[model samples]
Target: MADDAPRRDAALVALDWGTTTFRAWLLDGTGSVLDSVRTADGALTVSERTDSARARAAAFEATFAWLCRPWLDEHPGIPVLCAGMAGSNHGWAEAGYLDVPAELSGLADRLTVVPAGDSVVHIVPGLRDAGPDPDVMRGEEVQLVGALATAADRPETVVLPGTHSKWVRLDGDRVTGFTTAMTGELYGLLMRDSILARLATGEVGPKASAAFARGLEAEAAHGDERGLSALLFTARPLVLAGRLGSAEVADYVSGLLIGAEVRHALRGDPAAVVALCGPPSTEDRYRLALERGGVSVRIVEEDAAVHGLWRIALDAGLASLTPTATPASVLTAEEQPS
Candidate 1:
């Protein structure tokens, strides 16, 4: 095959469409990525750019066509599997949710189908917890599926850290329950508009690591008794007292917030080892926090979404493996074609 030749083995187009990021992968019969596209054309952005529901849907369709035109053109009738906010009520199609304790395998049976130009898109439904304290998640469910598939051991607890960090509890393939924390959102708010942001200067560097550790230690010690409000306030005073450098304030605050989240999450659902699935930077921070909380960590591949979409596609009969198809190992970040 030429470098630019169309892949006749392409079996599925996997999409991970979130609030502010869009990623699509063209996968072969064995789930190896043949081609991929990533952009900032998220569901939220697409919704905001349009007025009415009709316009919003049209915009989403147009965006999808624009991004995957080549793949759709070359491989007509190829199955497209999407997971995330794109299936939300306000998104291209309302895929709805499966209330917990839902079986992970059953997700393949409840896909929402949307006709986009000449292609049919299968959107994965989100998960919902409807007890006294209710919560819902859209995109993280697929990541969970991927994480479990690629995990060395099926973890009892899984943490997907992001803008809204998810702490998921699973028994085998069943998702018993989960909780969401506003750790990342809070960090963004404080860094962008809080009083601490005024004093924070310079990039977080090697010196910031010690400050971050201090914040985690402080949260572990005083977060329960003194409260997070008091712990966060101490950041300002430490800088004023010539103890913490201005540049280290961001990492210090990050440590405090992530530490508090980890401490509380572990207390609620203690586990021996937790599967941490996320980007490298976010995973590093959570690994530190979780280890500090005395739990062993197993890092799931960051590109778990692609693997997840592949699994769901196979189970749903949207795609199939060929007899001649050779299984390929998951590609690392550097190994993926640009």
Candidate 2:
């Protein structure tokens, strides 16, 4: 509990750093979630550093220091792997994004470890495309990698549906690049806080079959980037014309997002391997959309992140598979009820 000493830890630190918050997972050797800390080390949140890279490393280290020695004693020589925005140009000494196939094939040895006191750190690179477009993402690849491995040669589109739902094409062990969609954040803002908020509430879905299907069809019919606005307008018109209920707008919202997602997945990568991660039901809707788009489908199990992190850990020097969970979290099941 010193103010200046290098606080020690015994667990591998797996950080899911994003633009808004930094989620640090203290994991045991066996890849289980032990204690975790949710800190406000997002890029903009730190004002002390002069440049983005310095800011990122500064934010990262501050959050890393919060964990104590007790966890470290139990899991010594802990290696760390960070994903998400933490690897952006603004993040700690950026590790370049790996091409699709190369990443999915499994990077058992391609971990980027940085110097941090006596311990070492690994940063997972974000995914970028050959196109000039600047859409990028990090850490999510670990989830996708996890989903691919868990599915065990299952041919499917691993969609990590989130603030930026990624439709990744995976054929066997190879991830043939992917596309990034801003569906999650858009939906949140539009339905919860935007002009559409007047007609919206927090009660959305568990699997809106009809609404989801309708959205998929709308997107397919509209085609390409324009599909987004078209779908939204269609829903608004439907609601105004008294053809759809207010409650059903959730479906309309869902459809708009998923419909766009399906289109992104089908055209994201030529590899045609899609898997769903993040929120559960969203994947099913994406699957239904894929089938409607004349695409095949498959399902991957949980622990994709943990397993993905494990692969990175092994590369970072994990001699054994000793993993366990310690139920310590910052948010309640309600504030972050999953």
* Residue 286 error, candidate 1, Å: 0.7
Per-model TM-score versus the true fold: 0.90, 0.73
- The superposed Cα distance between candidate 2 and the true structure at residue 192, in angstroms, equals 4.8
What tens-digit string does per-residue lDDT give for candidate 1 at 51-106? Answer: 88899889999999999999999999999999999998889999999999999998
| Model 1: how far residue 142 lies from native, Å | 1.0
Q: Residue 259, candidate 2: how far off, in angstroms? A: 0.8
Q: Candidate 1, which segments miss by more than 4 Å at Cα?
A: 1-8, 202-208, 324-338
Where model 2 places Cα greater than 4 Å from the true spot, the runs are 1-11, 20-22, 34-52, 67-77, 100-110, 115-119, 131-135, 154-157, 220-227, 240-242, 267-274, 294-296, 322-338
With candidate 1 superimposed using the best TM-score fit, by how many Å does residue 236's alpha carbon deviate from the native? 2.2
Best by TM-score: 1
lDDT of 2 by residue, 1-338 (tens): 55643333335777777666677677755666768777667644543454555656766555555543444456656666777675667666577877645545345455567765555667777666666664666777777667655665665456677777776665566666567788777877778765566664445676656756676666677756565765676666777788877777776677767776666656645434445566565656666766676766665664577667666666656434653333336656776645
